[model samples]
Target: MEVCFVVGRNGAGKSQYLIDQAKGNNQDSLYLCNTVHDRSQELKTSKRFSVKNTGSHPNNVMKSVIKKMMREGTHRLHQIEKILLYCGYASHITVTMRAGKIDSRLDDFSDTSSIKKLTEMIDNYFNGEDEISFNVNFGETSDISSLSKLENLLHQEKPLRHYGMVKAIEISLYKNNGEPVPLLNASSGELSLMTSLIFVLGEISGTNMILIDEPENSLHPRWQREYTSMLCSLIEYHEVKVIIATHSPLIVTGAQLDERVSSSIYHPATGNLEFSSSTNIEELLWGQFEIISPKSRFLSEKLAEKLEELSAHKVSLNQSIEFIDSASKASFDDGQQDIFIAARQLADSIARG
Candidate 1:
């Protein structure tokens, strides 16, 4: 799989470029974008091109994936676990068979007993239920059995289906301490990123081109740093080309470490695309994104004004340097205090002149 990152600022036409790619490409493609109701409905009508409206109510996507898992099989266990681990907000997960109220935690089943507790529970209580619903809960100690293991253990009494038919699913979340985390809270950047992966892994395959716009949206700085690599690791085996659009420097750094990944910068003003060959984050941020000063913009602006004051003799060079030093210790500097060092150099140059 080839992963290309489209790096640019907001209003850069990155999303529009993705839409155009889907429209122009002959191959089957999936465009994942922010949901604009009328726009999404119109795009959904295309046959070869599939559109997923994300960003607005992303939990709906996860609910659909969970329901699909219940209907199909539990083979997606590894994928689900990986997402939970990556998100780091929860430690474990519980999936309840909502209709039958059957909770299958593998720990509840013992090796000494030939039959598991869940199978016994189903046989004794949930038999003859026509429809089943699975409720997913995070942070609960739920060691769900794999489909094969469950089938082997349950087959002694009856086929797994004899208990109930798969129908619907509800998803819940919690903190590591087992306190419930609201569903709305779970629909954060972590969930958004996980939802994108689940959507792609669950539905996309077979040489499809995947277009994901701003996967870094609302992600923490740490998550942004890990997002690209995490995504590439999951989808590497699939025969697909992925194009992700983002303005995050942390995301750009991830692509730099991977040899297989490629990137380009979209100049929204000129409508030009520049292929990015540099592996350095500083260079990429400055050269490609035109972010000449990758420092706190407010701090940078303040420093610039102070430099102007120094040039105008309103402040001495030492006073300017002291000002820079003071600003360096100030809050909202965003770890780019090195701007002070540069300002000190400029002040020294002014003094020499």
Candidate 2:
């Protein structure tokens, strides 16, 4: 009721959809999409929503914008040009006029401030001083009264101040007596996942539209699919709406493969994104994606080099130096050429990517 996922592939317009949805005709709610408001070409007609990427790079607009700027010279900003496209790991965030303002914690996506490049921004505001006034805490509860330290400080009538929250994350706890045990140390995957949780936890007003782009970043295969289910559950139980842009089959599977979940997906094509729906979200995501033609697949350079060496060395392999010598070997020219062509193609393709 409150949330709907705008699912699609990279560059397939998921971000634009969220912006438009957030900016509904009345435009009375807060909107957040880190950088899309500023980086997207649809900025003006985009209905003007607020967005932010907690894991933003020290730079703005993601790398794609930078590359475009380098090429386009002084073109209108993506937010203005409607040419903004996603590049992996871009920091973005925006917000438009909201009724009164929603919870602010929805911005957490990764260890953004910890990035050295971000230090300057966090320290100095537009006024060139540490004018920041907000709490970045490890606790999830909006009311600080529940936190031990915050409680103590409030009881003592002392000031409560927050510098920044670091790489804190969520973990499933197995109760040992009364205390909770951590699942494991953090990995990049865990960081990405926890950040997503942190983002949603902040904005959970029940029956709100929550959107995400590429919710599969940095997660393991298991986490990838589970994360999709997690988002779906959030939408269903809380009456929230969600939209996502992604390239992961695991995530696409979440929508298409899960009977318990309702989802839709989009893929990139020549002009626009092609859209599809599946009650079986998982099956759809895990669609029969196999190499139909073995030759169509590329090999790694290491494998190719090994093949080339073997092919050039004639009598297969032997303990004798006579059979294994590279320069001194007299081998079949045809087989050597064949291996060389395949290996070269593989090497070149890999290099291009």
Candidate 3:
């Protein structure tokens, strides 16, 4: 369970790094990316799988299943049921809903037959006895040990509910008291955590390598701090190597704590990759990650210069205040405003002493 992290700014070839790693290990790699453009085209022999493409295709197998179901006449609910059946093998099974088509096709079922049928189909597909079973095998044959391992991994987290009868196959988290809430209703951090975990647990097995681009997307600082631990738990259960691309300092800090995890910082300007062991978020940000804004960096340098000059001379209180005020105003970046203000207060205190 080796975990290697790639940290860099946007356009630093982080995605390409994953692609290169995947290509090098072609036969056993799985790429899960969120980019709009298909990066899978670059993979000569590796496999690409994402939430969008998982079990979503009109292949011969699916077409045959749909054709057999459609022979029972044009019932919209029946069509949806067949699609779910085809996707049943996937861990993240879902049905696609087009409102215009639904309104047009099910117009005849005005007595709410459409709603009833849709509900019934969802219940049958997901709520049945075998629906929650982790018997799926991406390549290796399913075994009792593997199924138990997956089941235990899923159970360790909050149970997720399937919003199967709606627009698409959506997942919702269960509240402490066992009430299910929609994914939209959850906080951005919670959603990010759940989505990443599910994606890993659902696809990690049966693959030799897992590549994730920006696992920190939509995560809060606290959630970002926990991301690596969550990832490590999943990786521990499988014989897989994981590579992640991220810009989060929390993730870098998390990587520093684990000896099994390796961290690499990509410098876009120099086109170089360097190993990082810094646990301080500021060092990770300004040094390795280079995430500082130009405006902020300039203002910080100016403030430091002013402070050094003040320390060397007995500047008047009025002069010190004036310098601080001018520097504060010059620091136009919102993120650095607080730092400038703090520097001003410190300067004022020194002048008074």
Candidate 4:
């Protein structure tokens, strides 16, 4: 598995670069975006490519992939269980397939002993308050008998609505205490992580190339830090080249320098730059992110405007100095002392003039 981490500020052509790559090598390639403005939609003409619609619910794609795999007798129960567990949604997942509705029945109440045992069971069940049972159901919409037609529908943006011969995919997620977890109660980050994992480890497995844009969109900082490793562990066995575009420093540290390609770098040969984990985060911000100061952009812009106005004599030196002093003091933080000090020095020079 070869991973390329593309880092850059917003609108630096990161997503477009991925789109172009996918278009050029549309065959056996998968393009995914975790953004509403999915650029991969531009690749609609390329039928050989697997492109995800960021606007649609991720479950649509997940269900389709599960059906396709199920038809091939390759169950991803373990993989889905790992994804749910990693996202903190469940401790385990039980996948069951059935052609008809799934039903559960308690033993017939034949005697007093059986009734007493049932009462005890109910009491024990209620006692395990720490656990919950979550059910996720996937059923066929249309019963298409042909595998070729099933594959065609699975490739669509929404596969569940169309008719298919795929069996229902029922998964029950539970906690360590053996209680089910209501997967619908999961946070956006948990859902996003699970979706991305399923998308990668499911139908897109063994792909020639995988392009992911802004996978950190709904992920927490901790998940973002561990995201790269989790993804790699799932797909390391596959012969695939992965390209991830992100703005997170935590994600950047997940890959080595040779694996990182910055959009800010311009070279015909390569964009790889050494990104040592030993380097301080501040240097990463300054050099890689081009952040000159810890000050907010609003404050920096105001300071620049004040300096320009003072130089043009549009305001009194005392007024300008006082404004800069107050603004600097208001936005001051421990790490931004140097920025205020520089502003003060520039104000002093203007006052002396």
In model 2, the runs with Cα more than 4 Å from the true position are: 1-12, 25-185, 266-353
- Scored by CA lDDT, what does every candidate get? 0.57, 0.37, 0.51, 0.56
Writing each residue's lDDT as its tens digit, candidate 4 over 185-238 gives 557787678766776766565467887878888889888878777877777677
**Over the stretch 45-158, how does candidate 3's per-residue lDDT look in tens digits?**
555544355332222122222223223322311223221222122212221221111234344456566456554544543444323333232222345453343333233222
Predicted model with the maximum TM-score:
1
Question: If scored against the real structure, what TM-score would every candidate get?
Answer: 0.60, 0.39, 0.49, 0.55
lDDT of model 1 at residue 162? 36
Residue-wise lDDT of candidate 2 within 56-173, one digit each (tens)? 3222122223223323432212221111111122121211111112124424636544333333422332124322222212112222322222223222221111223122212222
Best by lDDT: 1
- Write down the lDDT that model 1 would get: 0.57
Which regions in candidate 1 have their CA more than 4 angstroms from the true location?
A: 7-10, 34-40, 45-60, 67-73, 89-92, 95-169, 174-187, 268-271, 279-281, 287-343, 350-353
Query: Which is superior by TM-score, 1 or 3?
Result: 1
Residue 12 of model 4, lDDT score? 67
Better of 3 and 4 by TM-score: 4
> Model 2: which ten-residue window has the lowest total lDDT?
81-90
